[model samples]
Target: MKTLDLLRLKRRQLTTLGAAVSLAAALLPGTLHAADAASAPEPADPHQWLEEVLGEKPLAWVKERNEASFKVLKARPEFEPLRQDLLGVLNARDRIPGVSRMGGFLYNLWQDEQHKRGLWRRTTLAEYRKAEPAWETVLDLDALGAAEGESWVFHGAQCLGPSYRRCMVNLSRGGSDAQVSREFDTVSKQFIKGGFELPEAKSQLTWLDENTLFVGTDFGPGSLTDSGYPRVIKQWKRGTPLSAAMTVFEGEAKDVAASVVVDRTPGHHRVFFQRALDFYSSSSFFLQGGKLVKLEIPDDVESGFWGPWMLLKPRNDWQVGGSTYKSGTLLITDLKAYQRGERKFKVLFQPTATRSLASYNLTRSHVLLSVIDQVASKLEEWDFSKPQAPRHREVKAPFPGALHLASLYDSELPRDELADRYVLYYTDFLTPDTLFLSRAGSDERQVLKSRQAQFDATGMRAEQRFATSKDGTRVPYFVIWPKGATADGSNPTLLYGYGGFEVSLQPGYSGGRGRAWLGRGGVYVLANIRGGGEFGPAWHQAAIKANKQRSYEDFIAVAEDLIAAKITSPRHLGIMGGSNGGLLMGATFTQRPELFNAVVCQVPLLDMRRFHKLLAGASWMAEYGNPDDAKDWDVIRQYSPYHNVSKDKTYPKVFFTTSTRDDRVHPGHARKMVARMTELGHEVYYYENTEGGHGGAADNEQRATLQALEYSYLWQQLGR
Candidate 1:
């Protein structure tokens, strides 16, 4: 469900499957022009008023629709029970508390029924190993919000490592991208008066030292880029006005953002500047002798520092030092040598046709590579201590689930102690998450925590199946069959996908989904189609812009494959996706309405033509394409869901969900689509959450309500 529209480009999520269905003749060039002609007010978007977001009329419309839809959805027999069960899962005190190492303690944020917001707490690693860790609260979000009279959602805190006494805590209202960063003293558990703080904005700040910060925020009108992100990165000194901050780096208004990332890695204190040219590419620079020294590398190639070692992962084929390195190859070189125009490198991981490096992390002495074989995950550890000839070893991990790796190394700790230890989290549809602590050089590991299963999984089983697309590309999908379910095409199956942005959909557990859907005998499917990283860069690049329709076609192929195999018929099949996948849901149903009976389109981008005009929409032009350009529009207009909804066709009773606080994708996309479809005599259900940003839920209660509403709607539409 990650929008991955570069909320500062920590892009780790992807999209689901979809279909390339039929396009009505009304969408033809002449007809499109006519419908968009001068006679119509705003032409094709007569329901443009809905895009006004918080306008009086739009809010009233949202309220009325929410009330109307909830009245019926609540009346369903399965709704309340589902809601209660999900709420239990959401508020369960026994749930594993994820922690991060900060100085002498592991910090965690815990929320329950009483603590609707959360508690920023800490405990010793020894205490964390216990069944019930004794937590000492550093800050109580519910208390802070109550005392401040702000509906603050904690966006996390960036504490200065080594000492970890000072922290920049980010808080967002409801759950928008705009974050207010306040400096806090961890020792006193209080915000520093008159310390460095930024008002609500999509801002980034890192502690260069206790007295200075590398800041990127909206300073004024010209400070923000066209995408509403910070165009300038400044170094702000303590006890100075934000306007007086010295500009360290600046990017053009057309660029996504300019940011300064300060790495206080003990002795290797370096300041890196990144100017994101687009959503997926950036030109990186480092401060050398008070001048910005640009990294002479491909803009799309990811470059980072691991101690004195330079890490590079080229997204495109890079030829250097008289040899060509293929895309998705993870290479390492000495930083000092690389800076001196020497391209001498050692290959840590090379991609085969079917295997691509998913992710990698560095310890004091090891390089842990998470690779993808077909769609499964594998871990490889390279002991980079001996730079010339590193030791590579295969790390055995649990499968049919995801194996997540994270370095336990705290930069503040002595390089020798914590750097070699890492955490691994494994989970799937049925398996509850198990957190393991392992040492890089040793195979032995200790289980730190394991989540209790919230659903009955006695007879449920998951299997991976491949579907041949129209272009003969084999798309993989995982299906979790419910107990006693037959393959006679009668199962109420819910197929989920998000096939965009190179974000691979790996195996993960969701108690809400498991209890409310699969536990109720619903078959769940996950599609690994084009526009995902399942097969790496080539797979993702194959579905961007003009060729984006391939993602839909690949998704359609999976649905067809399911029907052919008699797993589920069209009547009993439903589809669900969010963000870009929401657009997939829209395009799929419009193209082939008979293929699915239910759709849960959440926080989606529906109008492709005017999407650039929306909040953060301008940033995605590189991924989607510049609709302002007529050539790109020629192809985009075909798959644009809002434009393709046919008045003459019979579509499913689609359910649309969005949030008023979703500052990323505009709520107008959902509003206008619902308005257009409903006006065209189509049965549609719409719900606009007044809070909750792009995720469509603010707190656990709201999240539970959404699940209840969605599953209830699915059962009504697709279940017997």
Candidate 2:
């Protein structure tokens, strides 16, 4: 599932196997708590108690573990310095105030030392273009939270289309997925009396009109999926109570989720019901004349509307009206005509072996697409209003760093009056983020803002290189290292990766990494492995389910290449990843224990066999096959890190981190993994923050402390 706001948080090279030392003497006996080994096929998880998220016993366990880990890392001299440096970067007032165009005004949320909770404000477009825009405060979260005695964190808002005078403001307590939404009048700068409001739950709502709302929230029993997301959607009228709202759609309890999207584009004001059957599969239906008419398309194909046309992006090859559209092809068709049984389509973009559609945004009369060619970004604009077939033109923003484009289209404006404008964001390993405003079809671009450099990147250099995986696939990766660095394999290097969920890891500036690691003369590597969307859906599908091993193999290839190139050795090399990448780190730690000296696994899913049984893990069954199935288990068991951790293996000094407030991926995965390793005679460090959701940290200070501890651990373990 996509987060609602920002801050959301390879060639085979064989390495010698490290000799296994006697761990039985070093480990504490009977540390496994209590579980009958003969009760089940594999022993029942002895540390299952940790799964009870707010339980007193589990919290005590978390506190003890956190204190122990904190004491060791805090004792390091670099800890305090790292914390201060990161906190400074995070709280810098010079950072760019990113804006969103709404109601003919640019809205922005500012947070710093003065306003830690942030201030949501807006300014006129002309004023925003100036060096010092005069911002009018719409809401001060710090003040509101203090007045209400709540830890209210802004989750964002859904403003009514056209006028945008009314909005539903989403606020989360301590940065959790669950949020409390309240309707407010932007023009009046106050909560709307008797307006639509929803209590704390993993909920979402969108504006259907000034007084109508299409919402998906917890509506009592049997209204939520096993993933803890809403399974039912209701259409609530202005004067009616939410409890009496009309039920528009309902999904099964086993379904991943059910959400509604209301398109407000001129001539395409339609409401659509989206039922997510699994992580990557969904069925879409648009409301027409009081009926939910299901879209006649493959379940795996992603369907959406752009202006007056329906955009279809298929994950698998689809044959419609005897025409076979290749996978990864972006097909567009007239929305009204298609609904009336027309099977014709216009190809906006097609996939190649090296080129794929990264993403697409819409201008008033044009379609702007950001394409990835060999893991680099390129832009193109299509004018579909032409009498003949749509003509495509290149909209170039040439740069070494990754460039992402977002179109500035307001449905309230007419096509002729709309400006051909889009927002451009660019960044790399060393370069700070630069925001630009440019015309979509033309090259008339102006620098809107540039982030101040958070670290001294004078000697750092970024280079894109390829590593051949075991299957002979050329996987690309980016490495940032100091100039004049030697190839003697003495420099400390940290390789990071995430190979699942179609999420691409692009080259972006990281102040924490720059100050803590790069400034200390270290190499940083980002692997664009299979299962990531660096090359689009095809790249991701290549390493999913039964073929998930491809991702693990691809990661190992990059690690071996780093060592082979003599950039860093096993003694100095380290690895880190969170969420899905945490699974990657776990597999690497257990499967190739001799490859590195340090591993940082954060908020990860280590117990693959039981992953689906956890909180939101059931939603990802499509990404990783159901482990309960015997055939799938046979393949999954081969790489299940929790099951693979052996008492006899020589493992690296690993650091595991998690959060008690992570209602998405259960923190039990990390807790249980660490417990098993320790019980098996390996000492590991762990820290479970009490607050923060899946992103792992609530505010800037919490983020700073977490980064300091991690970098300190890496320096202590990898740096010589």
Candidate 3:
């Protein structure tokens, strides 16, 4: 018999058996007595229900189920196909080449021909003897003998001398709390003596001059207990002893980095110090002669929420660079004045609603800005040469499905010589990322390079639709369908979303989800629910704290819309989300159990009552109110999934997965929920990986295995 037929048969048999058992109990004199048959008070301890149904050791039963499921999934040929797709996507960019200029030489970083590892090499402009030519390697990463996993070595190199002849190489081991060893070099080939070693340092190094360098040191008496916020920034001079490092400028700012840009006039340098707090609220100051002078306004600025600073440059009188905070709002700030206790800033260009600023750069005379309008998924370029009256010229959106701002590179040529020429790189959900050069005064853009040309994106379709929530609120969702799919809407649908924390779930390339899920006769949907930044900050604030349940209701509305629209039936519907999104999955599953056939909950914060007590949970109290407060508890208790699991109600088959190394959201949340569900006579499959922090699986291989298991569970529950 087919899988669906078998499932139907099993369900019918189970129903008949349950009815027979009930009939037999009714006929028994003592068993049917009012006292014996009184509806048992709801399980006082919900967790006890798991022991009652799945035997005394609930976790052991979960382990056995997971192992059996893993075996069944691993043996399937379909599982191997997804694994192969994952490998292909990860290795697709293996030999790609990229070009840049540094240290008076044209530099190239590409995958080595022999070992297929990334290598950095440089060649002088005089050696090449061409105005514009292909770059060659001068200093390969393999020759440096840097240990494996230290791929960020390129970012550690900085030029020291005025002639751009000498370079300082700082090598870092491990991420975050890295041990940095600095080696001075006059030439790119070798390192000089008398190097300094920084132990247990989590800060990045910035060169002040040949002898003077800025090293950041964290100060808190000892280590900080809060993981969400950044460590305090304290500056130390290069020659200072490790024990005697002095505090130059210390505030609420966490990690700080400095950059020096030569003024258009010779012999003048504009040094900028960019500091961030809690990975947000980044501000930059222009330092002249080792003294803080002016503050450079980031090209994209709205509020202090702007972060992930890409670059800083003194553009004429204004400083320009890309700045993103929150998610949607991108602004170009023109620094008017910067002095102690007095600062003036102005927005050069701001994209309106439903549009997000992607890239902004200033040439000598004109400013170039890229904006992605979410309404149409279109890319537009605005010319702000005439700041008083900027003109927007719509450029073709880079990709059809979804367009993303990848990177921007300022031309090496003189400002006047290059005129209006600039490079723009963009990618999309289905399209391979590509780079193109656009010259001022010309509409024609030339392709510089493409990251993925072999991968075909011919038939992918992305469409936006709105679903009405229980409160009559409209939630937007993006749906991806396979090429050549019939409109009959019989395809299996996988709806994924995370609707909290002002995070906009923008559509972008997802090789794994695209090839493994959508490519295999399935539909993928991303719901832009209320808690996300799709609309604006207000959208997120609306669904936070007491209104958190709105996000869950919004997710259910999308799923129900998919079913009602015939996109997929309940039997073929699967929902998957992680972290905050994982909360959405738990609430949705418990509140509307029959709406989905399968759910993939990863590192979920399900135990709402005690979430604040867990790692990184205290910081989120702003988003999810503190349950300790009686008023907050009243609202939290209404939708806390762990507290609402009903013993009498049947729930959909759920696969709860978490990692032991997930210090952000405690693994106990998943464990306790699974235990509680099982005790309530609900079937649940649980998998707890031992590593990978809050993300769960560590290595790519482990990630692939876990993803395969998740998809397999969905197939077993929904595809049946």
**Which candidate has the highest TM-score of all?**
1
lDDT of 2 by residue, 583-630 (tens): 889988888888899998888888776788877777777888877675
lDDT, candidate 1, 338-446, per-residue tens = 8899989888888998898988877888999998886878888999777677899998887656778878787656644677888888888789989898999787889
Ranking by TM-score: 1, 2, 3
Please identify model 1 stretches exceeding 4 Å from their true place.
1-44
Give the worst 10-residue stretch by lDDT in candidate 2.
10-19
Candidate 1 to truth, TM: 0.96
lDDT of 2 at 604: 83
Reference-based lDDT, residue 192, model 2? 88
The TM-score values for the models, in the order shown, are 0.96, 0.93, 0.70
Which runs of model 3 end up more than 4 angstroms from their true locations?
1-69, 93-225, 252-353, 356-368, 381-392, 406-423, 426-430, 439-442, 451-460, 483-490, 607-619, 626-648, 658-682, 686-699
Q: Model 1 Cα displacement at 150 (Å)?
A: 1.3
